[model samples]
Each structure stands twice: as C-alpha cells, then as structure tokens.
Target: MSEFERIGPEPARLLMEQGATVVDIRDPHSFANGHITGAQHLDNNTLTAFVAGADRDQPLIVCCYHGNSSQPAAAYLADQGFARVFSLDGGYELWRQQFPEQIAQPDPHK
Candidate 1:
C-alpha cells in the first residue's frame, strides 16, 4: 500500500519514451536472463551510486520479479525525493510477455 503508482506496460513505455530511468532490482541472474532495454541493474553494490546519481525530479520505473517488491522500492525512491516514481504493475515477467521487442540481454556471447 504505497503512495507510488503502479503502471502497466503501455504507461511504462510512455514514461520510457519521455526518458524515465528504468531500474531492475532483481538478482544478477534474473537480470542477466532478460530485462527491459536500457534498464540499470541495481543491487547492493550499485545502490548507493544509484541513489546519489538519480535525478530527484526525473521519473523512474522500478521493476522486480512479480511487481510486489517494486512497489515498496518505488515508494522509497519517492521518499528519497525522486519526483515521479512508478512500479511496474506486473513486473518484468509480464513486461517480457507483452513487450518482447523491448526486452534485452546484456551480451548474447556471454
């Protein structure tokens, strides 16, 4: 029950088109498998930098395995002063199902 918004793929896409930063909070393995194109992988090690560097007024969309975790994460970002924050409604699983073209793997050769 966070104050942050939960958005479906289309809305998320619109935000992306307008330059929202996409952050995937999934594990490295999950992230490596596939994620929204251009998403920044955020884990413990990179989180501090993410927090410091993320623009306070810029929109952000946070995604997790099933959409539950991202809600809290998104709220936290908003509390941290990120002006516009959103949680991917169905998470990456649903996004991949609905937007195969927007999915990306870091390196196919890896």
Candidate 2:
C-alpha cells in the first residue's frame, strides 16, 4: 500500500484471523512475559531474517509497548515492500486490556 495504517484491537483481530502476520517490536523479555498469541518478536537481531523470509504481499501488523514505537517500525516494514502494513493502535497495552484471553504467557519452565 506504500504506507502503514494505524488499526485498533478489533480490526487487528479480524486481520489476524484472516492470516495477517503479527510482529511484536518490544524487547525479548517483554515479549516473553506476554504478547499476542502467535506474535513473532522482532528486533534488530531478527529484522533481516524476518524481512528476507516474510511474505511481502501478506498483511502485517507491527506492535509495541504503547503504540508509539510501532508507527516507524510499521513504516519501515511498509518501505521494505509489505503490501499491507499496520500499527496496532494503543499497542500491546490496549490489546491486553481488551483481549486478555488472546495473550500468550511464556511457560516458566521454558
């Protein structure tokens, strides 16, 4: 689409159900603590491999702590050739609040 759009929890959930790839840009610890189910954590360490392997034409949703950081990250992914890029409005925080049942917590033993 050449640009990223900001989307709220409900719309993001719908897109996810339709096979959108969800990426969490928060730190590893934060991601491990709690994140959207099926979310892939992305950082500088994994960005290259992610971009190299991801389906550019598929919808992608970028998430962060409070929704601020994801804007630029979404933009970057859009620039990288993603056809539909979205930033989760209010980010993981709002998602957790609105859909706690959708959250995935890491197993302590893992």
Record all residue pairs in model 1 with backbone atoms less than 3 Å apart, i.e. clashing.
none
lDDT per residue for candidate 2 within 1-110, as digits (tens), equals 25899999999999999999999999999999999999999999999999999999889999999899999999999989899999999999999999999999989898
Overall local distance difference test of candidate 2: 0.96
The C-alpha TM-scores of every prediction are: 0.93, 0.96
lDDT of 1 by residue, 18-103 (tens): 99999999999999888999999988899889999878788899999889999989988888788889999899999999999999
Compute the lDDT for candidate 1: 0.90
Per the 3 Å backbone cut-off, how many clashing residue pairs does candidate 2 have? 0
lDDT values, one for every candidate: 0.90, 0.96
